[model samples]
Target: MGAFLLAWDPGGALAARIGVVNVQQVLTQSVAGKEATQNLEKEKVRLQGLLRGKKEELDKFAKEAQNLQLEIEQKGAIWREEERTRKTTDLRRRQRDLAREQDEMKRLLEESQRDLTERQRQAVTQIVKELRDIVHQLGRDDKFDLILDSTASGVLFATPSSNITEKVLQLYDRKKKK
Candidate 1:
């Protein structure tokens, strides 16, 4: 114990200060991140409305086809053969139309989801890049020996005094505004 104390370099220990930051907080609190979230939400709502409209149109077609089928079943005994055949053909055509429209709707929904996901990914990448730059600058300006992302760094415990999340957020917002 005595030899260890005597050999210890106090200067090195004092120079190595650790800091923690919650990256999730920074991403959610940053102005640019908020804007991206809002944009994504707006796009989601638009897509949902479009899908709803398509569903309603399909429902109308389904109802009409059902009514035609019922009429054929109820009156086929008295109707001429040609009339019955024509009604059956119309019902089949409506069914085919419904199937085609359903497929189109599904394709549109998948495309919209893919587009939204890509946009979200791009926005997150941009925000992360900016965040890294800000954190790097903060580390330089504040003389931080090491700054860890508590959210991803698997830091089980850290004192509040060593947390720089709020400061990082402020700096990020300021930089974004500029």
Candidate 2:
């Protein structure tokens, strides 16, 4: 009760061939991966420097402010009554400025993280699409029913002959050259 077409279906052989192509290597070694890693490293270094500078500035300010407070405390109750209002105002101002600086740094860091994630996602999606297209072509050429990604599939082991890591890398390199 099954209908058969006149053309032959080489699904098994084609799927095996595509599997051997190993598109994961192609994506991992591609330019996108290199660029994403490079940019992320650069951002990481820049952020570290920014954090160090901010922390040092805050520490210096805190030390100087503490010394000023101690000087006022030691000077005695007579001068304290005279300058209490001005001292409180100055302390509140310093606290507010420090808080603002901390908040700004945190916001910038969060923005950088978001940007990095978006860039990585974009690069990955582009590479995956390219690999899928190549795999689809191979499948068409060989008449495969399905070409499964071993990484996303329930595959435990594949024989050396079944691995297409090198082939996909070569193809990727060729495409990059073009």
Candidate 3:
């Protein structure tokens, strides 16, 4: 409607019927989108729980190492030279082990997060593709000159009469039902 005009044709020779679609609305309201979102949320929560458990384990290990270091510091003066050296070496080894464990856990968590993000991205992309196809078909059937995503900046304002989002949603939901 007023989003854009047939400015090039002042004589009213070219009357283009443009349609708008609120893609974000379709994504949130559609059954497939809801299912995809729910699934992703579940996976996200599971990953968070796993990460929390691993962090707790690392925290416990770090606390144990700290306690051992404190013990050595308080008792080192009366200890034999060999015992002190052995304890110092043990502390150094434990420190290295802790560092390595933290790095490994960090890497694993990053990999898992990356994988989950990628999966969510791919799912959304597929859903968008489906919506695009439906929009295209709607355009063809209704003889619309152009179909714009109202969610995009290209469509600043569109008349309600021109928005096909509800129609598109109905069609999309029906398609997913099969």
What TM-score would each prediction reach against the true structure? 0.88, 0.74, 0.90
Per-residue CA lDDT of model 1 for 1-178, tens digit only, reads 9987776787776345689999888888889889999999999999999899999999999899999999999998899999999999999999999899989999999999999999999998998898899889889988898999999999999999889999999988998888
lDDT of each: 0.91, 0.68, 0.91
Could you give me the TM-score of model 3 versus the true structure? 0.90
lDDT (tens digit, per residue) of candidate 3 on 1-178? 5535535667778788999999999999999989999999999999889889989999998998999899998999999999999999999998999999999899989998898989888988999999989998999999999999888856878899999999999999999999
**Model 1: residues >4 Å from true position, as ranges?**
1-15
Model 3: worst 10 consecutive residues (lDDT sum): 1-10
lDDT by residue (1-178, candidate 2, tens digit) is 1334323355643222435444555666766556657877787788778778877887787776777677657764666565876875676677777788778778877887887788777877877787777767766876665566777776677767666666566665667668
Clashes of each: 0, 1, 0
The TM-score of predicted model 2 comes to 0.74
Off by over 4 Å in 3: 1-13
- Once model 2 is optimally superposed onto the true structure by TM-score, how far is the C-alpha of residue 159 displaced, in angstroms? 2.2
Residue pairs clashing, model 1: none
In candidate 2, stretches whose alpha carbon ends up further than 4 angstroms from where it belongs are: 1-24, 76-80
Model 1 lDDT vs. the true structure?
0.91
The window of 10 residues in a row where model 1 has the poorest summed lDDT is 7-16
What is the Å distance of residue 112 in model 2 from its true position? 1.7
